[model samples]
Target: MRVLLLDNRDSFTRNLEHLLVAAAGADVTISAHPQAADVAAQRWDLVVISPGPGRPCDHPGYGPWIDGGTPLLGVCLGMQILNEHFGGTTEPLPGCVHGRAEPVEFLGRTLRVARYHSLHAATVGSGLEVLARTRSGIVMALRHTERPLLGFQFHPESFLTEDGGSLVHSALCLLGLR
Candidate 1:
């Protein structure tokens, strides 16, 4: 499958691109906010939103690209995008929610990964489901109600996260990539 990787000022876009390429055997195209239009001009089967130091609301035009029915993978700030897409607010997780954990207590038990963010959005819209979260109630994982949209609040590309590689692979699996 072909996927478009959104560049959010984070190198993880390239990192995930490689990881996703090796893991899912898919062609990934990387693009930044300025080049978003060009990326949209192309035909992509899915979109992967990588973590950025910025907020989704900051990029008003980007909402439509993400809200579209195409499958999506939201990571870090990308996760917040999913929440915002579903009408949620993103504030700090009360503290530095970026670190390593054995397994965060969500619906089940998701391995702790690097979460580098201070701003979190609180959802006010609908069409989103919480797939995972920390004990602090910061929604970490979410999905779109209508299409294939998955959001994760952690960086699955950091070497500290051994399972991150597999986590992204699982996202592709959900999209039937494997």
Candidate 2:
């Protein structure tokens, strides 16, 4: 599958790329500076938004892909971007999890995932469904109601996440590429 990896200059970007290629059998393209229009001009089966350091609101270039009908998977800051684009809100967490494994309820099943973000989704807007959350009630994952878009608050590409491959595979399945 042809996958576009919109990198936000996160340190784990290379690892994420390797995982996508090795595990998902995807032809991955890395873009350091992604613009919505430029991205829309190309053909991509899936778009994976990599985790970054700043607020997703700060970079508005990704707004074009939110409703473009292609499957999208957002990680960490990418999740916040998806949330904000869909009218949701984000806030600073009371406690930050740096390379810590926490139990998260995902689609009714609990799994340990690596957490690294300082901000979490505070409120999800209309047409979006919460798929996972931490024990303390922080939103850990979400999916679009009417679109094939998913977001994860945790870093699934990191080695810290034990089921990271499975999570990524699930997203590939969502795109019907598996």
Candidate 3:
């Protein structure tokens, strides 16, 4: 599969890139947070938004890509960006979680996923369905009801997560790429 991996100045982008190749067998191209026009000019089978530090509002120029009808996978802050694009809100997580593993029910199974964030989705946007969440009700996974968009609040490429490759594979299946 042809994939466009958008880097948001995040540290885990390289790990994500490897996972996309090893797990999804994707031909990946890395873009360092390119402008909307640059992204719109390319032809991609999928666009993977990398995790970044800061609130969703901190990263603009993604609205056009999110609304362009292409399949997208957003991680961490990227997920927040997706939520904000659809009118959802983000707030600081009470205790803030970073460099930790949390258990959540995903894809009909219990999985421990790595989390590194201080903010989470406060209210999911319209037409987006919450697929999974932490015990504390933090949105862990979401999918647009009528669009080819998916978001993961945790880092699927982190070593702390079990079966990270499987998670990536499942995401590909969910997005109809597998």
lDDT of 3 at 172: 84
lDDT of 2 at 59: 66
lDDT string, candidate 2, 37-153, tens digits: 565589999998889897877767887777778899988988899999888998888777788887777755677888898888999967889888776788888888778899989
Q: For model 2, state the Cα shift of residue 34 in Å.
A: 1.8
> lDDT per residue, candidate 3, 1-178, as tens digits?
8899989999999999999999988999999875846656988999989999888777788887898788999999988999988899999999999999989899899999999999999999998999999998889999998888999999999999999999998888888878
How much is the lDDT of residue 48 in candidate 2? 85
Q: Give the TM-scores of the predictions, in the order they appear.
A: 0.85, 0.93, 0.97
Better of 1 and 2 by lDDT: 2
Candidate 1 at residue 63, lDDT?
Answer: 69
Question: What root-mean-square deviation over C-alphas does model 3 reach?
Answer: 1.1
- Candidate 2 deviant stretches above 4 angstroms: 36-39
The lDDT of each candidate is: 0.72, 0.83, 0.91
Residue by residue across 13-93, what tens digits does model 1's lDDT show? 777888788777878888777245677777788788878776777755556776566778888888787777666877655
Q: Please count the clashing residue pairs in each candidate, in the order shown.
A: 14, 0, 0
